[model samples]
Target: MIQRSTRFGHLLRSFRDAPSSSSSKIGGYLLASTASSPLKQACVSTNRDDEFANLDWDNLGFGMVPTDYMYIMKCSKGESFEHGQLSNFGNIELSPASGVLNYGQGAYEGTKAYKKEDGRLLLFRPDQNAIRLKNSAERMCMPSPSIDQFVDALKQTVLANKRWVPPPGKGSLYIRPLIMGSGEILGLGAAPEYTFLIYVSPVGNYFKEGLAPLNLYVEEEFDRASRGGTGGVKSITNYAPGLKALTRAKNRGFSDVLYLDSTNKKNLEEVSSCNIFVVKGNAISTPATNGTILAGITRKSIIDIARDHGYQVEEGTITVDELIHADEVFCTGTAVGVAPVGSITYQGTRMEFKTGAQTVSQQLYFTLEAIKKGLIEDKKGWIVEIDQ
Candidate 1:
C-alpha cells in the first residue's frame, strides 16, 4: 500500500489520477478542485475551515493533508515582492513559460510549529528558515522576500489556520513556502516575474510507531551532487533525478540511497531527503557543504549541540569505507529528524553497524523536541512563540 507521507512529499505529490472532468467530491474535505489538465499529483481539499479540527491528529502519518486556505505573494522584474494572498486552497495560475517548469528556477523552505505545553503556539527557528529560504531564492536567481515579511507572513498564515495544526504529540502542520519564476518566456533564462506562496497542511509523525534505523544502499553509479551544482539550495529539481535510483534501491529493500560526490564516487554526500553523518570513537563527522550537498538547518544545529555536549565533530568529505567503519551512523533533516543507519551496502558488500543509533542522536532528538515544545531552556533562543 502507498504510504501517506509520500502522498504529497513535495509542494504536492502528483498522483496518476485524471483531473476529474467534473468536480466530483472526494469525501467532504475538498469541495471543488481545479486541477490542471494532465494533473500528475495534487492535495485536493476544501475550505471547510473545520477540517483540521476534526482530523485524527495522533494517527497522522506524514506529509500535510491540505485544508482551507493558502497564502500567495508575487513579484515582477526589478520590482520588490508584492503582498498577495490566495484564500482558496487550490492551484495557482502559472504560465507555460514559467521558470519553475522550464528553467527550474524554484526554491522552497520547510519548518514547523509546535503547541507549547502552555497552550500557546511556538515556531521552531522561523528566522533560520527565512534566511535559508532567502538564500535558496538567491541561488536559484530568484528575489528574496525580506526576513521580517517572511516571518510575519508565516505567523499570520499559521494563526489564520491555527486549528489545522495537529495537537501536540500528534503531528505538526508542515509549512512550505515556494517561490518560482513566473516569467512567461521560452528563452533559456530566468523568469521575468516570480511568485512566492506559502501553504499549510497537518501531517502525522514522520516515523509512525517508533524510530527505526534505515538500511541505506550507497549508490556508486549516481552521484547526488557535483561541484557548482544547485545541491546547496533546496530546489525541487534536485529530487526528480533521484526517483529512478531510489526506486531501484527500494526494490533492493533499502529505505533510501546514499549519494556521493560526482567527481569521485568515493566521498559521501547525503541521502535524497536528508543530510548524513557518521559517529566514530568520540567524534561525529559529515560531509562539508561544498556547493553540492544541502546545507540543512538541522544538520548545522546537530553539530553545535554535539559540540556543546562535549562531543567532537567534523565536517568534510567522508569516504564510504569510513562510514562502514563508523561506530554508529545517522541521518538528519527537518523531516524524519534523525534516522539511525543500521547498515550500508557498497558495491554489493553489505556492512552492518551496531544499532541503537549514536548516543548523541537519542540525546539530540529528545532535546530538540523539548526545546520546540518550550519545556526546556532554549539556549540559542531558537524557538519563536506565536499566539503571544
Candidate 2:
C-alpha cells in the first residue's frame, strides 16, 4: 500500500508489471473528449483525414507529415503525472530549462507499420526498437520503460493514430518514441522526472529524390565512432561532429559519406544514418556491431534474407580498399534502406562497382521488401499488429 502515496508514480511503477494476456478482444476504442493537467503543457489534435488523401503521391517527402492524432504523457518533480493519455496530433510545450536542452539527454527510436493488403496493420520488428530505446535510457542514466509498458503504450498510441499509416504500397507510419528530462533546472544532474511522448506521421519514401543509386564519398578525415563511444547507441550527440564531412559530401553532389574507424582510418564503417554492406560474388559483408556501429535492424534483416537466398554473409573489419574492390555496395537503415552505391570516391580516386541489377544485393532488397509488405512468410515472427 506504500506505493499509493505518490499516486501516478505507483501507477507508472505498476505499468511495468502488468499482464498483457489477450484473454479477449475489446470493442472499438474508447475515445477521450478532454482532460485536465497541471504538470506542463500537453495536448493532441487531429486534422481532417481527407487532407492526407489529397497529397500528390509523386511529390511526397520523408519525415512525418501532420497526422490525425498523437499520444502524450508528462511527469514533473514531486507531483503525479497529470497528462498520460492518447490525444490529437499537436505541438507540445516544454520549458527552456528542461534538462534535455542543456545536457543533451534526449533520445529517440524509429520504427514503422505497414498496412497490409488484407487490411491488417503490421509492425515490422517493433520490439527491436523498444529494446534499443531501453538501451538509450540506460546510457543516459534514465529508467528503462519495461518492454510491456513500452509495447502497450505503443499499441494504444498506434491504434489512436492508425489512420495516419498509408494503405498498402502507399507508404508507412513512422513511429517515434522519445524520452526527455522534464524537470526544469539549471544543474548538471539527472532530473528525477521525465516525459515520454510517442508521435506518428504517415511518411512515404525516405529519399524525396527517389530511391535511386547514390554516389558515396569515402571520408577518412572525420570519425563517427570511437572505441568506447555512444556511436553504437543512437544518441543525438554522435551526429553533430560528423556533420562537416557529411555536408561536404552533399555539396559535392554525393548522397552520403563513409565514416572510418576512429583509431585507424583504414577500417570502413557506416555513414551518418545507415549501416554499410557489400556484395562480392556470392559473399555478403557488413561491419560487425562491435560497440562502434549502430546495429541496424535492416542490416540484420538483410543478413537473414541473404542467407535464406543462398549467399554467405560475413561481418567483421571491412577496410576502405575492400569496399573499393567490392562487386556491389549498399546501406541499410529505417530511413535510407538498401541504398545501392555505384561508385566510391575516396580522396581523389574513384572506384566504380558493377552492381549487376540481377545480383544478390537487389535480390535481398526485394526479399526484405516482400516480408515488410506482408507478401512473404514471416519466418522470424517480426510483425506485430498495432491496430485491432
Query: What does candidate 1's lDDT look like per residue over 1-388, in tens digits?
Result: 2223321222221211324442333323222233342111123334444524877765777855776667666678678773433354665666676788788888898887777545687888888888888888887888978887787667756765677877778767788888889678697877888877888888765654347778889887777767888889898778889988999998888888999888878888889889998888788999999889888988988888889888899998798878656888888888877777778999888887666634667877777778777878999988887643
**Superposed Cα deviation of residue 47, candidate 2 (Å):** 9.7
State candidate 2's TM-score: 0.84
Worst 10 residues of 2 by lDDT: 20-29
Query: What are the models' TM-scores?
Result: 0.84, 0.84
Model 2 lDDT tens row, 242-270: 88998899999888888888898888889
Pairs in clash, predicted candidate 1? 14-40, 14-41, 15-40, 15-41, 30-45, 30-46, 60-204
Off by over 4 Å in 1: 1-52, 207-210
Clashes of 1: 7
